[model samples]
Every structure is written in C-alpha cells, then in structure tokens.
Target: MGLRPQLMDSTRSQDQDQNSTQDATALIQQLEQDRAWLLEQIDRGRWQEFRLDLAALERELGQLLQRASEHFSSGSE
Candidate 1:
C-alpha cells in the first residue's frame, strides 16, 4: 500500500520534470524563430518592423529572466 503511493508520487515528479524540460525547449525554439524573423526584417530595411520584433524579443527575454530569478529565490527560500 505504501509502495503504491510512493510509486505514484515518483511518477508525478517525473512528469513534472518532463513538462519543465519541454517548456524550456519550446521557449528556446521560439526565441530562435523570433531572432531569425528580426534579422530578416532588418535586412529588408524595415526599421519599423525590426523595432517591433526587437521589442518583442526584449519582452520575452525580460520575462525569462524574471522567471529564472523567481525560481532561484524560491529554491533558496
């Protein structure tokens, strides 16, 4: 009985870890796509479009930084 509960808890932990890994991978892919799009816009001499993309990337980066900070702070606590 106790073993069954432990097994379920272990499985849940594994699933949570896997989900976090998938989320990180997706974020990296999104950042790469955004960077490519920004470069293309800049190469085309579309300053306005470039600015928009740059702003978006900056926002994404800022969010990621905040998330990392929060995770680390919580871990320490």
Candidate 2:
C-alpha cells in the first residue's frame, strides 16, 4: 500500500519548513557578508563596485522577502 494521505501531507509540510529555515539562514548570512563587503568598499572608496554590489543586494533582499512570505503563509496554515 501507498503512504497515507495525512502522512504524505505532513512530510511535505516538514520539508517546506526545513527548506524555508535553510533559506532564511542562508539569506541572513548573505546579508551579513554583503554588509561587510559594503563597508570594505566604502573604506576603499570603490564607488563603482559598491554600486554593483548594491544592485546585487537588492536582488538578494527581494528573494529573501519572497521566501519569507511563502514560509509565513505556509506555516500559518
């Protein structure tokens, strides 16, 4: 026999939770590294590279927000 429906649903939910937690942790680490890189750039006066990193940071932040929203909605359900 196949897995029970409830068991499958629970497993799926757990997987989502695990993935979401990992994503959030990785995002936080990325942000910290970005912060350090920004400071280093500022000290070195690398304005051009700083601007490039800023653009990349925006993308990372957007992805983080999207993942957080998905996780929040799913967990609340």
**TM-score of each model, in listed order:** 0.57, 0.52
Say which candidate scores most in lDDT.
2
Candidate 2: global Cα-lDDT?
0.71
TM-score of predicted structure 1: 0.57
lDDT score, candidate 1, position 24: 66
Q: Candidate 1: where is the Cα deviation over 4 Å?
A: 48-77
lDDT of 1 by residue, 1-77 (tens): 87999999999998987777667656766766676676677567777746777767766775775676566446444
lDDT of candidate 1? 0.69
Task: Report the Cα lDDT for residue 52, model 1.
Answer: 74
Count of backbone collisions in candidate 2: 0
* lDDT of model 2 at position 25: 64
